[model samples]
Target: MMRLTRRTEYGLMALAWLARAGGRFHSVREITENLDVPRRLLAEILKDLSQAGLVEAVRGPGGGYRLREDPGRLTLGRIVNVLEGPTIFAECYQGDCDLSPRCTIKRGIGEVARRLEAVLEDFTLEEVVHGPAGAPAPSPSS
Candidate 1:
């Protein structure tokens, strides 16, 4: 089954936390303490986000990381890409298979991956964590 990796999951959680923090810098310590994510891993993820221009980072005691772009405008696909490259729904999607020359499932599975990616591109981070108007996000089961 398709699922998010731990690294990508943590990235999303950290972004959601920063979004809830409003327009203020929050240190890694504070983020780690609250989110319970590992400091080292979170640091690496934040660096990637910062390099990707998704987050603004500052050094110094009072310096921290914050969203560079509005969360409402940040797509989930973009975030996932920044943190984890791209979505791979199945092995055949990568084109490394020896069976690619005559693979029957490759085309169909690739289409599904593309469609799912389009959905991700349209769904913003804010909407993912909070419903349209600050309503609690509905679980996938909903």
Candidate 2:
């Protein structure tokens, strides 16, 4: 059941698209049209990503958005955090459970969440773009 929200998904998709396009500034309209994502939602997600310093926004005619840093330097975890805030696998893991001190389940869940986050942190945006060469680009829907 662990899944990235639609916002994060679209953000990554847009980022990957930008990466493939090689640092080109792509307008929101172009992104929405090519990616089949909702225009309003993509705008909000792009804004969030820009605010997080993950993407850069340019204004005026012929201006648009592009990645603020190299794709190889951007981690998936960071993008997810930007779009969705901190990733927490379980509510009880946030020290909210009355039985936290004695709950074995909470401890196990925390470990799993940490491991998952670690995996995400290790995967950079570049890995998503190139996709082992001849392999087809991984679709966001996957």
Candidate 3:
């Protein structure tokens, strides 16, 4: 039962909304009201996005958040990494678990995580938000 966490879902939703804003900043209140999301949660999510360089934050009056990364080039994998850190098998993959000595799927779990990241990288924000007609997202520069 693999699925996106609430934070990733809300973060992705906020990004799509901001991308559609055509570069104009949108306050957390505005996004929360429009998307029916929790204000405090959204603010924290937005702060994480801002710190990750995905969105730029303008402080004070007449200020809010605007998309900074080019949506056309941004990959879902990158977003997930920023919001949730690297996808991995965690302790099991690191051989720190009690069953690491006999875990049959430990190696397989690492492979699954890598494949998942690659699949996610195949699509861009534009493709995900709009449609899948565009070419694959360019290879990550770094």
Q: Show pairs that collide, candidate 1.
A: none
Give the per-residue lDDT digits (tens) of candidate 1, residues 1-142.
5577788899998898888775778888889988889999999999999999999999998889999988889999999898888666778988776756777898788888888899989999889789677787544220
Report clash pairs, candidate 2. Answer: none
Give candidate 3 regions above 4 Å deviation.
Answer: 95-97, 134-142
1-142 per-residue lDDT for model 2 (tens digits) = 6777888888888899888776568899888777888998999889888888888999878778999898999999998888888876777777777755666697578888889999999989999787765477654431
Give me the overall lDDT of model 3. Answer: 0.80
Stronger candidate by TM-score (2 vs 3): 2
What TM-score does each of the candidates earn?
A: 0.84, 0.84, 0.82
TM-score ranking, best first: 2, 1, 3
Error of 1 at 21 (Å): 0.4
The lDDT per prediction is 0.85, 0.83, 0.80
Encode model 3's per-residue lDDT on 57-108: one tens digit a residue.
9988878999887898999988888888876645676656676577777767
Q: Rank the candidates by lDDT, best first.
A: 1, 2, 3
